[model samples]
Target: MSGGPAVVTRFAPSPTGRLHLGHALSAVRAHDLARGGGGRFLLRIEDIDGTRSRPEHVETILRDLGWLGLAWDELSFQSERLDLYTAAQGQLADLLYPCFCTRAEIAASLSAPHGPAPVYPGTCRHLSPADRRARMGQPHSWRIDMARAVERAGPLTWHDAYAGEVIADPLAQGDVILARKDAPASYHLAVTVDDAAQGVSDVVRGVDLFDATHVHRLLQALLGLPTPRYHHHPLIVGADGQRLAKRHGAPALAAMREGGADGHALSDALRRNMLPAGFRLGEA
Candidate 1:
């Protein structure tokens, strides 16, 4: 059981909307994993996207988690940890470069597809000093120099609870943004940095983020941070056979609580992996 000590885990939810069934499953799973082994569970509010994140949604998140009987040892918000992210960025500055391309410009520059979405063409990676100087006033974000970063990190692997040991392939994502023009840190950077800072030993999240792990593994290697065991659980899906999302109009945990639903009963069912009728775990 490797039960030497309790492994720390976290559930980071962005407060862009109300807590949904999907969020409930994630929080409960993480809390159980921590408490099951005499470890501590932590909560993190990933509200880096100021434009979309709302204070009301955050209040609802705490209320929903409490109703579900999921409690955390400590609570941290990304908004309060700006300096930590900035310090991490400074450490990786050598491996990052300024990206000046706008959304429209990036889209226009892409002809061949790299992945599901358009991969950045690295339009500004090789910019001349004069050209860079000319655009100093333009807002720019920082991107990881994937080539150098992977070279430095070498071949890497991370363990998964179900998938076993897997090799990392961060190149597929190309040069991902480390810092955003609107936010101090991108999700990839912030989550990686925060996990390391918070001493999270295990990462419990949805399989939809399985691919993103490749990039996170690279970041951990580059930043000299310890790699945590990951369990990419299946996502909760709606009756329409689609992953639960706001767009899908999935029922919110708050709505369920208000409608006379029992939080303790829901938590028990979730602990037993018995989702309500009509709802099931989505395929990887």
Candidate 2:
């Protein structure tokens, strides 16, 4: 929050699987943005989803990044900092309500037959905390208090390096998930808290999450966080023009390693795509 022209950016990754093309692009862009400004690039392990997160995955990520030749100035682990995430959860406790509405319930509540976005019917937003806790003891997910959040902060803006200006309405994204039905903390809550605490000035990621800016902006405003610049690069899609997903299968980094595939080639490809060789933020 107390910085000048130096851009402090971070590249966060989840340790659920081997790094893919999308991850490579995000890491490279983040590295370029921070180094481009003669600033700092940080690495954050987003292992909020305890179920799928594995220690081996974390180790492999470090290996993958080293192979890519992408450098970082700082490193953080979301799992290691549970207290922060817990504090944010407490801040959002009453502010956030328990969502007992299952997917079936939400779908049934969709009254706008032809609306572009399926609006929430506010099925569980009005539950008392005690009642919510009781239901949560059984099973539930938690959402932010959009009504209170909007009242606290008006509409916020996000400036993207790739896209133009962007504005978001928190009310539309009613009650986003800060915690899952099973886990206590969520990716959104952990990422926002980490970014705010680290004074991250720039966010570089794949354009596929362009809409997520709205959610992140809302979190920043609600939590009184410093708004950071966002830069979502073009996603690397398959020949079908679809995002790289596990279904279609990406060449696992382990598989590549066994095949004698060099890791630097990944970053080299990324450099060729957007930034030139040896190009930093200032030069970019």
Candidate 3:
């Protein structure tokens, strides 16, 4: 780790599910990175999805982290920062537009053979003033005008500890949602704002979000927010050679704790890159 600003890292997990081994690895990495640098580690609950987030899950998250001996300097919840996200959306108003497309409609539009997740085609980008006015009362999400935003921000770049300097290409995921009808902020918008607001200097997480960093870099540029150095670590995979998830029967940290498994030992094992019988780290 190069010497500079005091590292500020965060373990941000959504309260929609319990902490699994993958989450444990991420949290321990972020915690160690901050503490090792004589910096700060924060615990943030990403509960922006009101429909899925639950209070019970949040409690379990705190309990699990405590058991693992990862004490945080600060704690926060995304649900409590609605105004910040709203303010960010306001700042980017000129580069945003209302998107009223439903999931079914979007899926139908991209019925042709494509990638696992198809980029959204701008169906409502060129709507006339009257057309937009007529749909103002309908449920809608605010999406970034990718072309205009990129043009305004010019070229952009961000650094990852593993991948080195990366040229941002936010255009690949066209017009992503910034605010949703159900939630005040989408993951992309809220995370960018929160990381900046919390002064996170080092973002340590799984490699699954490497591509998402491109979009986040663009957002930081557009919002005039500082970009943080990222560390996209490999994911914990099961014996089946798949990333662990609830569907794969990934055992939760809560279960381990209840079973009287030693949390410190588990944390040490993870930090030392030691895994249980059938688990290993891999880019999934």
Candidate 4:
């Protein structure tokens, strides 16, 4: 099957919020990439964040996709695949460590300018056995030891359709959380596991996650998963030159559809790279 059909693509969206125009563009891009070439288009619900994800939003997602004339060949839910994430976490035991630092504590301990997210200072990374034993049963999160993980994985690179071959620098993000007390897996871990498990050959998403691809590439190497070709597309922003978000009051697809906008017309416009009034495309 060396040349069997085109590579499979997916549109994995979180059910935490309503699908907006930006989301539609991403879904349409992924869907067209697969369907236009006679390949399969898969849909995966990234509902790992149970606190925010809502059933209503999931239903809206389905309806929105249908309205957009998009159909996926297969569907998957992350909530139902806990065992897979757990198994992947176990495999990285050698490169994982417990992070007992609270958000406030981390903020107070940062002496260097680590930008928006204060890179974890590794305060509890080398805690003595006695200290760890005394703090047993305390709420904590699991983080990958970036230094060790990078060393173990050696030099790694991933091919991006837009950027070409890119070298991975996982340490740039520091020790990203892999597991929390409430959630078994983080975005980095779950996404890496799911893409591999679902046999995703192409990753099409917004460029805002371009930097994250570096960490994912490293994780794929460490987890022995095949690296998928990436295509980080530009994001759709409002006329204010800001990326659309809930706070920005970007109109949701459901709202537009309810407002009498034709679904097929909208889809056709997006396919032609046209944005709605007061919205424009920008690279992330």
- Top-lDDT candidate index: 3
Q: How close is candidate 4 to the true structure, as a TM-score?
A: 0.95
> Is candidate 1 or 3 superior in TM-score?
3
Each prediction's Cα lDDT score?
A: 0.90, 0.76, 0.92, 0.88
TM-score of 3: 0.96
The CA lDDT at 197 in model 4 is 94
Over the stretch 240-267, how does candidate 4's per-residue lDDT look in tens digits? Answer: 7888776567789999888888888999
* Residue 99 local lDDT, model 3: 90
lDDT per residue (tens digit) for residues 1-284 in model 1:
36486689999999999888888888898999998878989999999998899999989999899999888999989999999899989999898888899988988788775555577888899998789889878999999989899999899999999799999999988899999999999999999999999999999999989989999999998788999999998998868888888756788999999998999799889888889989998785
Model 4 Cα shift for residue 125 (angstroms): 1.5
Any runs in candidate 1 off by more than 4 Å, and if so which? 1-3, 112-116
Model 3 lDDT-worst window of ten: 111-120
Residue pairs in steric clash, candidate 2? Answer: 35-281, 36-280, 36-281, 36-282, 37-281
What tens-digit string does per-residue lDDT give for candidate 3 at 2-75?
57778999999998888999999999999999998889999999998989999999999999999998999999
TM-score of each: 0.95, 0.85, 0.96, 0.95
Residue 222, model 3: Cα distance from true site in angstroms: 1.0
Identify the candidate with maximal TM-score.
3
RMSD of 1: 1.6
Write the candidate numbers in order of decreasing lDDT: 3, 1, 4, 2
- Kindly list the per-residue Cα lDDT of model 2 for residues 173-228, writing each as its tens digit: 66677888766677677778899899898988777676667878888776778888
Model 3 residue runs over 4 Å out of place are 1-3, 111-113
